[model samples]
Target: MRKRTVGTGILVACAVGLLVYLAFNVRLAPIPNAVAALKTVGMTCGSCAGKIEKALKPMKGVAGVEVDVKGGWVLVGYDTNSANPETFAGAVRKAGFQSWLMEQMSLADFRRVTGRDFGAKVVRSGGCGTGGCDSGGCGNAI
Candidate 1:
């Protein structure tokens, strides 16, 4: 009677809520006006870049991370209020690589010298037959 009506109403509300949740896409909002550029030394291959990315991407306030293996540069977009360039540099160092701030003038000069845009997005996700070799040169981890 009354109990059955209340249960039916609750079930309908739950079904409507589930529909709404499944119909919409949820994502994190991007940060505006914050980009950190780091000159990373010792990135010899894509795996190196992947390791660096894996270290920095989980940090708080990091919106996006882009690595340029050929240019030895890492660009990180984040919220300026919660993160800074120094944090990224430290992460790179912790991952066993030296890093430094690429000043505006230096960045421009590097771009000119390399004749390639440094800001291009990097794709470091593992692919078929992509892996690094050990010091003994046993073999690549393909």
Candidate 2:
């Protein structure tokens, strides 16, 4: 009976030690900075948006990318240290579409292009539309 008790105690102690070690060693991966969003022209259909998203998705530092055909915007999440706004634009251009890093366009413009506002809140936040308007004149300048 004493031997069984000792064995059980040892097992319990080992389990507690394992739990503590795991607790100390386990770490969550750092969340990467997202690219936020970039407004561009020439995205007129779901397939167009898909092409843009596919192009940007594999670039270094890109965590997530969403291209809205109706909204004419590409919302991207990226690791800023690994990529930047320029890189994102380049990716879109490489995909055969003209792209630029324009500020978030007006809700009216977004609606006109995309037909919906998945990124309307970002526009409302007022950080968008700060960049220069693109050649297509979908920005605040007009």
Candidate 3:
């Protein structure tokens, strides 16, 4: 009957609208023009990711933060005008996580070199030699 057709049409319209909303919200976030990829360590769970995010999100020029818990990366999008990677490293330290700036470059280069899934091959700061770290030399410079 006409009532059934009207109901079906309304259901279809709602489904399409829901899909559109998800398409925007679920899509990968756009990387900022200037990004710093920090090879993160000691971040084991979602709570750890939240700690890192809380540390970086309030920074002066930090634009975005993407934490890959499994991949062990903390991708921080920041403005070069008022932000430096050094401050970011400090924040991570305060949050009880170890992070070192692996690369500071354009979005294109970052995109080319890394992915959100496997950021395993990144170079660590490792301020100490193979002898082992003395203080916090493992994450930041000694």
Best by lDDT: 3
Deviation of model 2 at 16, angstroms: 30
On lDDT, who's better, 1 or 3? 3
lDDT of 2 by residue, 1-142 (tens): 9999999999999999999999998653323444456777765445555667678877766656666655677776556566666778888877766778865333355456658653333321212243332443323221
User: Model 2 Cα displacement at 34 (Å)?
Assistant: 3.4
What's the lDDT for residue 56 in model 2? 80
lDDT ranking from best candidate downward: 3, 1, 2
The global Cα lDDT (0 to 1) of model 1 is 0.67
TM-score of each: 0.58, 0.49, 0.56
lDDT per residue, candidate 3, 1-142, as tens digits? 9999999999999999999999877634433568888988776555566678889987877878888766788888877777887788779988887788887877667666666422334323323333323443333222
> What's model 3's overall lDDT?
0.70
Worst 10-residue lDDT window for candidate 3 reads 117-126
Tens digits of per-residue lDDT, candidate 1, 57-138, equal 8787777778776667887766766666677888888887788766422334545665644345454533323224455221
Runs of candidate 3 exceeding 4 Å displacement: 1-31, 114-142
